[model samples]
Target: MAKIVIREELKPKRVIALMSGTSCDSIDAGLCDVFPDLSCKLISGINYEYPEHIKSKIFQIFSGDATIKDICQINFAIGQCFSDACKVLISEFGKPDFISSHGQTIYHYPFDERIDNISLKSTLQIGESAVIAENTGCDVISNFREADIAAGGQGAPLVCFADEKWFHNKNIAIQNIGGMSNVTVVSDSCETFGFDTGPGNVLIDYCMQKFFNKPYDRDGKIGFSGKICDSFLDCLMQDEYYYKNPPKTTGREYFTKQYIENALKFAPQNPEDIIATLTALTAKTIASAYERFVYPNVGINEVVVGGGGAYNPFLMKLLRTYIPKHIELKKHEDYGISSNFKEVMAFAVLGYCTYYNIPNNLPSCTGAKHRVVLGKITKHV
Candidate 1:
């Protein structure tokens, strides 16, 4: 057996944080050592892409109208994936003290309005944490969003607490572009507000899968080689969702195949041109959001880009053109944290907080009533 040393403070406490992102790409597993009082040190992080067949089933089931039984079954099935991924990590790095799984967010509707006294506000993150805990022989914390929503918040942009703790600077906007693009403005005053800007890779990914038969546009090769279509850009910009005020959140639900089809209907364009315009759409929306909310409020001197979109050169170039030349543009990796792993590592940190009864949600980011400790715990026997 390989030699292993557990910190005296964390003698029997380890945590695994798992996430299946909106991109529908893979399962990201991060393992860490967390002490009794919520201090965490990441040990390892890895990703497990779903087999194509399984991925197809999940996408099909989650994308549109589906029977309630299918939804219930897939929840357990997603948990099994998390459990399997954790098992692999345990075999490679050792069992954990606990697990924090973000699960797969199938639906999240965070708004409630009423002319009378009736309103509906709910969010669902599927994947059975109890099942994962049972399978892994470790305590688990999952479904980390409901509490924030109940407090009258957007119940999203959850990555801000991690951003504040790990990457916040005096005058920088931390922009994370995953399936959706979101920005967190951190000022010298220490005030922060983060909301999803718009679709990140979701639109681009949809276009690629339709036109090229690939999951993603590999390093944006296709977009780089294409020209923007003005008509499509005009059509897509018409979405009222794009112009909505802050405290808003969206998902694959908003930027779906149907949405793309509608945009394409007004102005039919070639596939390559469509990709370019979509790529520009992400860049422009991100830049515009920062200019409006972040720069005006905090006066940004630098923009720190992160997440999967940080790797897209075409997107980066467009961002440069859109933002002021005086501001520096860079990736989060320059700060010693890998952009791709930051969110996965964040859940690990949250797991530590939940274990120690520390609050993880930032009220400024989520617009919650107050800073409340998030996540529901399922303990190991």
Candidate 2:
């Protein structure tokens, strides 16, 4: 190991932040100008699709069908995928001061599950930083969750740190409907907090593929065409994850294929109806989570929606229907933020904090015992 020096000056840094969310659809790479104040401006962004073969392997691991050798090999393999994504940005924008890679989260177990007296509150994100550093000839910061988990946090909904910094003073909920939905409540009345609201597009996307052989319900058209089964929606709303208090998180590990298959038993027979019901489930859970956790504590003035769900007009329509009429509904673009790359920009801020040795995790949101700088640096050398 080599001694690493933290940056002392408050200078702006150009960073290329790379990540692939729970969707595992594409590797999102964003080039940003991160300022000393931790504010970031996205200079450019790209969605680099994963090679079909590599993507299949990731799904295999998610389904618990892969061997240890497969996991070991895919770490570097996905690192190469991330590096390739960075190269696309680097070719046009040039090499950044450093690269921040969130890698790909294969599994996140922020639970109280114990094994042989060992608390298994852990997470695993696989793209190898050393491979990225070596291939790109640039310093890389990866594994942003371990430190927070070490501090007794759930190691998730981490975007709240950036949400607090970016939307401070505004009484709003930055709701991201990614593969799974999560919200960061930035308010003036109470401390910033957030958690996974519930399933986002995961179930809908799965059902779309299973029923229509499509990747997702574009503009939520399929969902709009069908009627929502309220009986089934009620059953889904009773999911235990929605009832759990905040400072919590979940991923595909909990909402696995098996879980989805079991859920389908209660679903409507029509595929479109199932899709519509699942979309409503996403919207309803988000609204219900707020009614339970946020509305009581914070007087939210607006709900700014982002991620793939924002593009789903039907989902947005359902959200508007379920959420209170008094509160305004807006998109990330309204605030000059890219819905697709906002998470990428958030990691850019986290990496910048790491470079300057600043504590980046928000304790209130993650339930960490304290603040901690959240990434590991892999130097190009």
Candidate 3:
């Protein structure tokens, strides 16, 4: 392990942010320079796909009923993967002041009751930061969820920090369509609000893999080629998950294989129609959530999209139909932030914030009782 001191001449600072998303497909790494206060500049980013076996194992614990020991072992292995990705990032982009790794979340269930003083609510993110620090010789800040939990917050949509720093405007809906979809209401006063809207690419990917033998409907081609089943769409729209208010968060746990099975019971016999229906389900649910909760309150003028879902033209088109003429629907790329790499950029910023002892979680978004500094530090000592 190596410890590197910050040069006095560097005013703000720099860090590499790494995130392995819910999809378990790969690791996203981004290098960024940040001002001491909170400004950010993206330097470089790349995605590294996991080996097939590791991918399978990740899906196993995440989707399966793995025990505690199973999870602990996987955490260390995932950490090594994180460290390897950091190595690749530093080799190309050079060193940064610190590293923030979002690690990989295997399960997220925010709703739980209390036993004694502690709430049973919990979320799990694998990938040990210490391994990352030891292997990369860079200080690492990670486990961004604990502080939010301590504050009684949901510990989600941490990307809102990136939204505030890079995309904030008086009248924009910063929509990030990741494995899940979340939107941030950005206004001039810094009083921002965001939450996981619903399923983003997660359901789409699940449907495509189960039926079409594909990872995802690339560019939403299959969805474009298929016709929507109105009945299926209607049934999906009625799901209680859609009606839940803000401060809510969900994951593969809620939208499980069981839920899909139930939805499929009424789906059209044709798998293509089912795919179209699921894609429509995602787009409509997202748009509906925005129109219902965000538009009236914030009076949105722009919808800045990010995450892998931004690549789906069909989803984008569907989103446009629900928004207003006064509002703009576009990708983060249009705002100089690559949609695919934005989350990576966020984790980098979070790492820098954590290292400087800056508080990063927003109480409004996570419903936590108060603001708290997020993450644990791992030293290369």
Runs of candidate 1 with Cα error greater than 4 angstroms are 1-13, 34-41, 114-116
- TM-score of each model, paired residue for residue: 0.92, 0.98, 0.94
lDDT, candidate 1, 181-207, per-residue tens: 888877767577889999999989987
lDDT of 2 by residue, 113-137 (tens): 8889888999999999999999889
* Model 2 vs. true fold: TM: 0.98
Query: Which residue pairs in candidate 3 have backbone atoms (N, alpha carbon, C) closer than 3 angstroms, thus clashing?
Result: 17-348, 152-368, 153-368
Best by TM-score: 2
TM-score of 3: 0.94
How far residue 13's Cα lies from its native spot in candidate 3, in Å, is 2.0
Note the Cα lDDT for every prediction shown: 0.81, 0.93, 0.81
In lDDT terms, which candidate is top? Answer: 2
- What TM-score does model 1 achieve against the real structure? 0.92
Model 1 error, position 226 (Å): 0.3
Clashing pairs in 2: none
Name the candidate, 1 or 2, with the larger lDDT value: 2
- Each candidate structure's count of clashing pairs: 1, 0, 3
